[model samples]
Target: MQIRLLDLLSRIKRLQEEREILRRNQALELLKTLKKEYEELVEERKKVSQVFTKSRFFKAVELQDLIRLRDSLLEWEKIAEKKLKDGYEELAKIEEELLERHKERRLFERLKEKEMWKQSEEELKRLYRELDELALLIQGQENKR
Candidate 1:
């Protein structure tokens, strides 16, 4: 019924807020990770370039380290990218759900108003009858109290 719908609406609103917070946290985390990765990549590239400059034949250990750094950087970048995309997707869904909640709230408000108006009309009619009876009683008051 209406109560159930209202409860559901509140739950949905809370969920939407929770999702928004999560999305923001994910975005911030992704940015931090990406920045760290970029800094590391820059430092590694600088070192690798220095090694290449100093000697034509790169040592196996240096080559391996360079490759490993590159691969690790790539993996971190991919993870950040995926997290960013997921954060945006969650935000979009939350927004859509919020819109739906607004629509439901509006519908509920309209229905509530209509019910209130009907009750008021009925009460006014009943009060009018009572007023008429009181007026008649006052007019023929043989013993005014």
Candidate 2:
């Protein structure tokens, strides 16, 4: 039963893997998203910094606003890095589970083979016993004749 279930699970997983087209792609996609977000944040910061520069010659903008923007980007970058690391860790765990499933499937297959071999041996022994009995019956009848 486990063998069959494992086989089904593996097939489904393989299909999903094919659809995903390389598990590494997940990580790559994550990196791309993070890069895009970082770039957008940098652009936002640049715009704010530019405003501060322009204000110095014209209106007055607080330096605090620029400082706040830089701090927020730094915080977001740390969070993004953690998420990326977690994503990789999750991938590792999935691979480990797949490996464990393979091991279990192999073990079940070996057990099934052993059981079939035992059944075959018993069947062969029964046939030989039946043949021996027939030979003894014929010999007894010949003596009577």
- Every candidate's lDDT: 0.68, 0.68
The regions of model 1 sitting more than 4 angstroms off are 1-57, 133-145
Instruction: Compute the lDDT for candidate 2.
Output: 0.68
The best candidate in terms of TM-score: 2
TM-score, cand. 2: 0.57
Candidate 2, residues 31-136, lDDT tens digits: the string is: 6787678677667767776776776653234466567777787788677777767877866766666566556556655666666677789999999999999999
RMSD of each: 5.2, 6.0
Candidate 1 at 127: error in angstroms?
A: 1.6
Clashes of each: 0, 0
